[model samples]
Target: MSEVNEQMMPPKVVLPKLEKNLYEARAIKSFLLTAMVWGLVILASIPLFSVIYMLIVEGGARLDWEAITALPPAGFETGGGFGNAIVGTLVMVGIASAISIPVGVLAAVYLSILEPQSKLATTSRFLAKVLTGFPSILAGVFVYAILVITTKTYSAWAGGVALAVLMLPTVTLAAEEAMRQVPQRMRDAAFGMGCTRTQVIFKVILPTGMPGILTGVILAVAGAAGESAPLLFTALFSNYYMAELAEPTASLSILIYNFSGMPFENQIELAWAASLALVVMVLFFNILARIVGRSKF
Candidate 1:
């Protein structure tokens, strides 16, 4: 009777043993940890959003079409555009780039292509490093000596010259790095093709390094745009017509400074608007740099 009962019951099912996947478990755990870290970082952007919100709230009311299109403030007017400051900033920075870019590129080329054991290059490189660390206020003082006190006037030329000094190290370093990135084989090939050292550098190396050079210029321009100390001493302040190059020339940054310190709420609002505009201008250049760097020569 017992045998018949066992035979009637279903046979016990057998299942395959599960493999222990320690590696996959560990991988999943690591992925979770990384995702958590990034998630926390994303949340930390809340303050940045808040600041943007405050800026928009305070500045938006003052950013009407007329505020954007009107000329510089006239004798304590509540609302005025920064037209002259904008133009002056552009002209001064343009001149600064004109002076600095060529000299910087030349210096970079010399460092990359000239004597392998040059004491001059070493000295110049050390000086550039020192200059990079120099405080902006010190640069302003230097310009003050050269362009303001000695010249006895605050010319736009003086401001441009000050900006040139401020920009030189950045351009030189960027250009040198770009030059270093040029493949040695290309240089060798150029030499093999009966090209002179100058020809190879100017034609092949420079073009390839154009990306870095342009990046340097953009950074320099951005830096010059935000500077206040150098401009303060060299350019001083002006609320009226755009002064001569040898006289005080107000800038957007200078205006922001002057306006923000006022007791008027409207002036403070203008400061915020101006600050936003400056940030946008810098961002514009950064975008331009990316576009230029990616373009085919």
Candidate 2:
């Protein structure tokens, strides 16, 4: 049996002394600041919660199954469900997303994977950055000047095009960021295995970056949804039921804008209810995007 000498054993390493109590207090203060920020976020949410609560209290009595299910009323003074507004919002948003997504993703892919150092990419990136900073009203004005007056009509198509412009920068920047987040090693390994650029991007990068892209799309949708100024000039508003895409269609935001100024309590209540609905819908979509983005396919 080998005799182990206690003194011969390696001296047990001692950890450096922790910083003084004052340093610990400073650390605690830093943690408290973080907690305070979270508390502020919670507090900020209160106004939205309060608005929803108030809408529920006032509009709940008027909200019957029939009222909720029925279409918009034939007359302006008469009450009706916001089904038409709902449909208009969906159609416009769908068209806009369709137009924006492909272009944005393509632009992002080029910037991230193809010609990152090229002057053309640089110019395109600069343009996208400029467009992102462009006012929504300016977008509305641009569309109005180009599509509405030139085409000589207010159309859902014009509205969609305008919204697409607004969404493009958001999607492009977000997708580029998302693609950038993918590890270079993963990309290198795929390339090392003789994978084509297209194959690596479509098969590897996009999948990994999907979560962030989805979040960006969600944000874009929410931004577009609440945009009254842009729609004011592009989508316009109609009180009557109209089936034509070329005709001005009423949106929830537009309707709220038109109705909110009325002296009548009923119309005002309707506006509140509509606003609440929009908020809830946007919140639902944001949550869905987060969940879907996080989920494995």
Q: Whole-model lDDT for model 1 versus the true structure?
A: 0.81
Q: What TM-score would every model get versus the actual structure?
A: 0.85, 0.85
lDDT of 1 by residue, 28-121 (tens): 8988899999998889988878877876787666766665556656445667776667777887788789999999999998887785359999
On a 0 to 100 scale, what is the lDDT of residue 209 in model 2? Answer: 91
lDDT of each: 0.81, 0.81
Clashing pairs in 1: 155-245, 155-246, 156-245
Q: Give the poorly placed runs of model 2, Cα more than 4 Å off.
A: 1-4, 9-46, 71-78, 240-242
Count of clashes, each model: 3, 0
Model 2, residue 272: distance off in Å is 1.5
User: How well does candidate 2 match the true structure in TM-score terms?
Assistant: 0.85
